[model samples]
Structures are given as C-alpha cells and as structure tokens.
Target: MTTTPRFKSDAFEAIHSAASGLHRSGVVGKQTMREFDALCLAEAPHFDAKSIAAIRKAAKVSQPVFAKYLNTSTSTVQKWESGAKQPSGIAARLLQVVKKHGLDVLV
Candidate 1:
C-alpha cells in the first residue's frame, strides 16, 4: 500500500525523493520509511454514509469483518453506515487506506 502523500509543494516532493533514495540505498530502514510515510499523509477525507457503505462493499466483507480489520465494533460500523455516527481520527484514515489500497492492507 502506498503511504506517500501527493506532493503539494516542491519542498515536500524533494524531501520525499531524498528519503526514498536513502531507503533504496539502505541508509533508511523499512520501519523508518513507514514512519516517514505516515508523517507525509494528508488529512483524511470525510466519508458519508453512502461512501462508507460503498467502501465496505468494495472490500467484499461483512460489517463485522470490516469492523474487525478496522479495530472497531460491528455496532460502530453499522452506525457509520447508517449515518448515525462518523469515523474520525485514525478510524477515518484507516478507511481511506482501505479505500485506496484494499482491505488486505490491514490484514
């Protein structure tokens, strides 16, 4: 899964390029690259009920299973899908990851 953020500025772009080179040269470790990638992440998008349900469908998993991957409860997934609640913080970011990379990334 790609954790790289879209380059919005030349500075960040250059930084990422340099870091990537370092990683490729073994000056940076996999764990460090992952940490850098996390720091490069953009703000998570807000998912409406329909969008949340669509993502869940795309993953081809039941609500309970999706919740398990997301480290949330089935009831929370239901609430999000039903528009009774919204996922914020890490939860929202995780949904974005699953939406972009697929459910297997979490596994």
Candidate 2:
C-alpha cells in the first residue's frame, strides 16, 4: 500500500477558522458564499448587462467619465453601459478593479 501526504494542514485549519469567524460575524453568509463560489469557479463577476448599467448609473458618471476612469474609450463604455457590447480582457479587469476601488486612480 502507498500513502500520499497532504500539504499545509495547519494553514488550511487557520484559513477555515478565519472563514468561520467571518460567517459568525455575519460578514459572510450563504449568499456571499454562493457568490464567492461562483466567482472562484466561473472566474467572472455575477453582474449582467443591466446590472452593469445600473451600477454605472448609480455611480452618477457619464460614459466618457466612466471610460476615462476605466482606461478605455468612451464608445466602449457606451457600448457596455447600453448593453450593445460586453467588456473583455483588460477592460473587464479595469471594471472589476474600479468596482472594488472606486475612481481613486482618476485622482
């Protein structure tokens, strides 16, 4: 019989404990866990076109301003926000970063 060794048992336990703390504190819940799983498994944001447009609208910025902040073109922003086109590659990455960090890079 052959035995295989698993790695970093202590580190895994520590991470699990931290996640449990987050769950206990209500910082993480079933919905959050599901979303996290989707993000990890699908490698994409959960937002759809309408949701992206709504987020842009809620940000209260014009397409040009939003595009500038995203380091993309105004036309591309219009396409994305209007659901005519989807952001991809670096554009998608920039959008994700901006969603998390706001327009801090613009300043």
Candidate 3:
C-alpha cells in the first residue's frame, strides 16, 4: 500500500506560513543573505552531487554560466558536482529554487 505525507506537508506549510507572516509584518524586515540562507536551509530541498549536476544540465547551462548566475565560481560549481564540496547555505537554496522554478531565476 502507498502512504501519503499529509502531516509532514502540513508541518512544512505551517512553518512557511509563519515565516511569511513575519515577513508581511515589519518584524522580519528584509531578508539578509544570512537569513535567506537559514530559511532556504530550512525550507528548500537538499541536493546531492548528482542532483546539482542534473539541475545545471537540465537548465541547459554550462558550469561557468551556472556559477555566474549563482554569483559563485566555476571551481566551486565543479567542486559541488564532483562532491569535493557541498552546496550549503545560499548555494543550496539557489539550486533548489532553480530546480523548482527553472533558470528564470537567473533572468
């Protein structure tokens, strides 16, 4: 039998809704890079080396182009793909957004 992830999804939505509410109010203010990193870490899907490579390839962008779009270095992107390093924090979030929303986030 197959099971549904209704409860887990509900929890994610609740946390996201609270974050949205804080943003709507003046309490949260604008998201700084650090805060954005934290939020993305909390909310975005985690990417493995294969996933990172797939995302870049799926976007039909070269490593350097993807690096430029992420404001990172081509060496870093290569490291991520080779699993010498992981895309944590901002890079991870950007990768997730790109996976979900496409390369439009670049333009």
lDDT against the true structure, per candidate, is 0.88, 0.65, 0.77
lDDT for each residue of candidate 3 in 13-100, tens digit (9 for 90 to 100) = 5665566577777666666433643553344357788999999999999999999999999999999999899887668878888998
C-alpha RMSD by candidate, in order: 8.8, 12.2, 11.0
- Using TM-score as the measure, which candidate wins? 1
Report lDDT (Cα) of residue 49, candidate 3.
88
The digit string of per-residue lDDT tens for model 2 on 70-91 reads 7778887777766788877557
- Over 14-60, each residue of candidate 1 has an lDDT whose tens digit, in order, gives 77778889999999999988876666645567999999999999989
Error of 2 at 84 (Å): 1.9
Q: What order do you get sorting by lDDT, best first?
A: 1, 3, 2
Error of 3 at 2 (Å): 42
Off by over 4 Å in 3: 1-44
Best candidate, lDDT: 1
What lDDT is reached at residue 70 by model 3? 94
Please list the residue runs of candidate 2 whose C-alpha ends up more than 4 Å from where it truly belongs after superposition: 1-47
Candidate 1 residues lying further than 4 Å off, grouped into runs, are 1-42
Model 2: residue 101 alpha-carbon error in angstroms = 2.5
